[model samples]
Target chain A: MSHSYEHPRPALAVDCVVFGLDENGLQVLLVERGVAPFKGRTALPGGFVRLDETLEEAARRELEEETGLGAKVFLEQLYTFGDLHRDPRERVVSVAYYALVKLSDHRVRAATDASAAAWFRLGDKPQLPFDHEQILRVAKARLQAKVRYQPLGFELLPPRFTLAQLQSLYEAVLEKPVDKRNFRKKILSMELLEETGEREEGVSHRAARLYRFDRKRYVALEKAGVNFEL
Target chain B: MSHSYEHPRPALAVDCVVFGLDENGLQVLLVERGVAPFKGRTALPGGFVRLDETLEEAARRELEEETGLGAKVFLEQLYTFGDLHRDPRERVVSVAYYALVKLSDHRVRAATDASAAAWFRLGDKPQLPFDHEQILRVAKARLQAKVRYQPLGFELLPPRFTLAQLQSLYEAVLEKPVDKRNFRKKILSMELLEETGEREEGVSHRAARLYRFDRKRYVALEKAGVNFEL
Candidate 1:
């Protein structure tokens, strides 16, 4: 059976907002466009969807192709942007996705369809082309909102980290100073982190205990629909 | 400048899951397909996207054209499903949306592209065609999870409702018996509802006082990023 339409269909595409964390704060991955309508301007890594791939697959493929990021990073669908004038050359409906990666684990390099790839501090990102600025804003808000009730911040941290590192991550994402005593009390009360019985390797001051997120317990709590308010 | 692709582009579409509540419980609006690719089978009200409208506009248009639903419903984009074989005829990508409406406010009638439209209790719905079943399941889960932290349940009830109605709404959506004392204590603590200075009328039993949702306060709290965890 063949399907044809009397009207022109909008082009389906996928874009990714990749967020990474470092000592400074949260960062976003952007690539210099290799083709027009926004040629030479920096944009999120993305491309048109292909017939053989799912939306997430297309996002991952474009991520790897444009920014040299691997497919194993945590990714989730953010939203679908379909403004009438989003693309000047055509009617393009983009399914946007957000990804979290460990900044220390993978260093990005431009490749394939992109001229250059780099991480920019959240507030210091260059003016984006098309509707990418709005997409990135939405992704940032989703990350901030989700971090309050979900254990998504762990994806941007190392496998084992100190309580101070966790607090720093939360402060960076939430953009506020957390009460040290209350933060520690609430986080420890959740019982979702287990002491690794190891100390920070080389600290100028008294080293804190290293802890690893208990993924199994988190998954069970999530499955049981337990609210994680932090 | 015009754009053309060397390969066939996947067709874009929009589908909406309309949720309503009644004395029986939560209900969903479904329409019987009037065209092929399901023909007479029931499915979510939807159609292909048009170039002139946005994805949400397309969803609202389809809902009205197929199910007699108006444009003022509280609708949100749920997710985009881009499975390769979701549509049997060709490669189709659909952006799914979920809408909430008061059952007492509107009477749905089948029109335009659908053969018939009707409401079915969530658990009593027939086996839907295509991947609509999965979309509906996701919408249900989203509603259930969100009601715990958001004031979305109020959208399904009448303008002036009793605290008992609000509790029933939560109990219905969460599919469990919520403790009365705890539910009242927590809900009142949020300070999101105000007395309407009216009592329920025309009831055989005791007429309880009516309350209305505090939309202004809710909007303010939402802007301030307050967590309404219940």
Candidate 2:
């Protein structure tokens, strides 16, 4: 079967900005291109959208194909980049998505048309090809703005984490130092977290109590008209 | 000059969800289609994208071509809809945009392929063609969720509006009543509005003081780390 149209169409593609947090700082997933146009240059994992898949499916497929990592995580549509000269070869429109993954869940490996895959600190990343640099900037700004009002910081940390760890995650994303006492008081008052009855293990310093995000309670409170702002 | 690609591409289009506020309530602009595949049906003003124009440009152009109302308004990309069977004739990917316009500024007029253009109360709008109803629903939800945290309510009001009118606009979009004293105190404390030293004219009731949205002050406050929450 074939499809025809009178007007010219621009090729659609999907790009993914995978963010993870670790002991160092906030990091972004990058893949080195193995194809020409920007051969051997680092860029976000993405590819042309196939006729069969949705934009999000295309994004996830490209992400897995380029970087050997797949796990259920927080993913959402970030923005659509469609400048006339965004693609040097042709008129291509890219629907970009941003994903947050727990660093410990999925190990990264390069495959397909990607020579290497690695996580680099967001601010100290290498130059990217195409319009990826701008897309990354937009995604970073969105993450910073949204983390304050939403419970997305939990996506980057382990399931059971200390308040210090959560605060560090917030500081990493927001690029600011948060008052620990105020942060703890505010977050605890929200009642979106549950004490895990455990403490951080394998640390030299004083162990902090661990807590898990209460997804069910959060959903209930959210439905009951509660705003989670930090 | 010509371009060729092996894979079939979906035809791209741009749709606009123009919102306005009046004495009745929140309203959305709809145009009657004059072509096939939902001809004569009410739909949001939109058309196919041109090669040279950006997605926003296409949306703005379509808004002008279908309904002759084009003043500077708050326009933002809402989402990109790409369901396989959204359009009956073919697979068409539409970039949806939501715009806020002052009803007093733009007088709706039908033009081009539009047989009629009118503003219908959002809750009482007619059945729209294609996935326009879904698009409108998404736009409405976004407007409601965004208005509380951002100062977007001012976009739907006149430049110099009374506090009562402002509260009404908020109540209309939020679909809920706000406490008068609480609303007034919170809004005034933000210092984002300036008293214009004018009063409403030609009304049956007593005149109310008029205030203008101080965009400059809002920007400064925003940069100085102030949160605008209702």
Candidate 3:
């Protein structure tokens, strides 16, 4: 059966720029197109929106089907891309989303509609088809700007992490080295991190202390108009 | 002309919540729908996306056609609403935008597809149709949260405004009583405002000195990662 509309409608879709971080730097997830239009070429994990699901639902579903990412990752709508010639076949309006995942937990594989799923270092990703490059650029800018105001980097780290790990997450996302002393002072001053009384078990040099993000306290402070800039 | 697709497609649209601030408080622009499927009901100024235009262009066109807002307002995409049953006629996915306009310069009149256009107080808006009430709520939350981290409140004020007007903009957006001394100190410390050497005119009260928002300084500070939290 075919669906029809009285007026012409552009094809609606959802695309995601999944960012993961580690000691090296930031990375993004990409899937090879298993079918036509950009056949066998790499692109962000996405597909046309189904009428039965919400935009976020469609986004999560696409991420799961294409990249094998779990549904529990930190996902947010980044922006909407509506270029007339974005898709070679027709006019496709894509609602773009950005997701942050713990790199260690993301075991990617191509499933359903893709031939392969892989992570590429942020600056060294393959040339993407369509307007996906612009989408990725916007997502990176949003992530970099948002890191100063929101604690979204926590989603890219382990639950209990060291100050070095937290600081490195910021450095990786912001793509700049920060003064260690000032970074620690500002993060600790916020009092949104709780020392977990646990230390790194396996380390080369010294066992750095571990800390957990105090989300409830952060929420309260945010409500009280506290600044979280670094 | 009718259009057919192999797969079902959700109709896409662009809606704008135009915010204007005055001595009283924040207000939103709404237009009475002249077409069917919510005819005669007041709603955000919006219309369906044309295949030829970008989403932002669609939003600007809808605002112009429905509310007669100029093209120079500070407009930003707020969020996308894609609930399964948001539209009774069909699945209509709306990319919502929020705009800040100086109230003193606004002259709203219904045009094109709308019967009337008017401003309503933020908290005292009339019954809205097609999930627009929820859209308005989201727009308000975004405005309140965004006012702290960015200098968006300046868009709602005239180019040369006094400290009292600035303070009132914050108070209105945040919906809270801010300490006057602290607010003044914080705002002044940022140096994003330049003394215009002008004073309020034709006022019954004492004339207050006017200052202009320094956009160049703000862009520089933002690029340098300066925190503008109030």
Candidate 4:
């Protein structure tokens, strides 16, 4: 086959840029490399891509193996970085992905092989290896852009979330304080959220109605040019 | 070096999803593949990545070799596809890029290798090789989305353009008619376009003032979160 006959292929790798929203702000997941080149340095949770697995499969596998994240989490390809010298040793092509998981489900158990895996406040993250710092910047920009058009903020919220939490999610991602009345009007007019008869118990103030993202309705309305803005 | 290990690597390929806007509406650049596996089939302009250069360079080289396009056009990484059976012959991973070029500048010329190269109306493109059709669809969707928030619509037009031409560019890519008054108000409010004291000639009606995209002002405003919505 021409694919195999022409020349040698470059090494392939996968990197994940995981994001979660917390009380302080957005946090990103990073793992300390246990092996060579950048050993002992913090980086996105990722590793080599296997021969048989596709990039998505490799990302999911690495996410699970390194950070104990599972298939149920939301993940999407952000971009690919294939600069020849991105990896000092050889021509390594890294396909980067961005994942959004709820901070409330904060049960991340680092794998044994990795020296350390932890969530760092995005603003306080250590210097990452290779082009990972650039990759994280792209991921944050993507999140900011997506939160306006797509109803992806639900990925970082509990199954039954209150209105205040949803507003906080949008505020955190956009990095700006939004008028509460306008935010509520804009989101509710889209009709992509279902109001459930539930409320939070621990807060001192009167709780708001719990809501869940109506994926089906969102998909249907999205096709008809519905604007899910905040 | 771990990168030097004799591990299996997937063949890297590049695919170009080029967009053009003309009087006939939005069009996409495509070529007829001359080589085997899918000979004589229409496909996106692309080729294999050389070991010496980066993937961006490889993409530019492939685009030039196949379609006679130059390196000055606007190019952005679209996405990466790494499905195992995406290529019929071997494990091939393709990095797709979307390019926007003014239709009046570069004349479409098919090189010796490609059987034919032409621009097809975006909505009337033929079934493409591999997963390129899906890639093209995603590219068009992205273009439509970006033209609203970013100054990308100008890339499809000549350096000097009128308000009507700019509105038409949006209408073409979006596949819908936009209110001229509303579009004009929204775009003018952004203050990213500078009047050039020129007008279109040979027109039966009143010629409109010519304008150019102000890159410096755009950069400043973009950093300020002032979205150029229209």
lDDT of 2 by residue, A115-185 (tens): 48888887788999899999999999999989978899999988999999999999988888999999999
lDDT of 3 at B187: 98
Where in model 2 is the C-alpha error above 4 Å? A1-4, A107-115, B1-4, B108-114
Superposed on all Cα atoms, model 1 deviates from the true structure by an RMSD in Å of: 3.2
Candidate 4 wrongly placed segments (more than 4 Å): A1-6, A108-115, A203-208, B1-5, B108-115, B203-208
DockQ top scorer: 3
B88, model 1: CA deviation in Å?
1.8
Q: What's the TM for chain B in candidate 3?
A: 0.95
List, residue by residue over A1-230, the lDDT tens digit for candidate 3. Answer: 99888999999999999998866699898989987899899899999999899999999999988888888989999999888899988899999999999987774343232448888897787899999999999999999989988989899998999999999989888878999999999999989999999999878999999999999999999999887877
For model 2, what is the alpha-carbon lDDT of residue A54?
Answer: 74
Clashing residue pairs found in predicted model 2: none
- lDDT score for residue A84 of model 1: 97
Clashes of 2: 0
The TM-score values for the models, in the order shown, are: 0.92, 0.92, 0.89, 0.91
The weakest ten consecutive residues by lDDT in model 4 chain B span: B106-115
- Residue pairs with colliding backbones in model 1 are none
- Candidate 4: clashing pairs of residues: none
Between candidates 1 and 3, name the one with more favorable TM-score: 1
Question: For residues A58-153, what per-residue lDDT tens digits would candidate 1 score against the true structure?
Answer: 999998888888889999999999999999888999999999988877653432334488888988988898999999999999999899989898
Q: Residue B86 of candidate 3: its Cα lDDT?
A: 87
Docking class of 1: acceptable
lDDT of 2 at A68: 67
| lDDT of all predictions | 0.89, 0.87, 0.89, 0.85
Output per-candidate TM-scores for chain A, rounded to 2 decimals. 0.93, 0.93, 0.95, 0.92
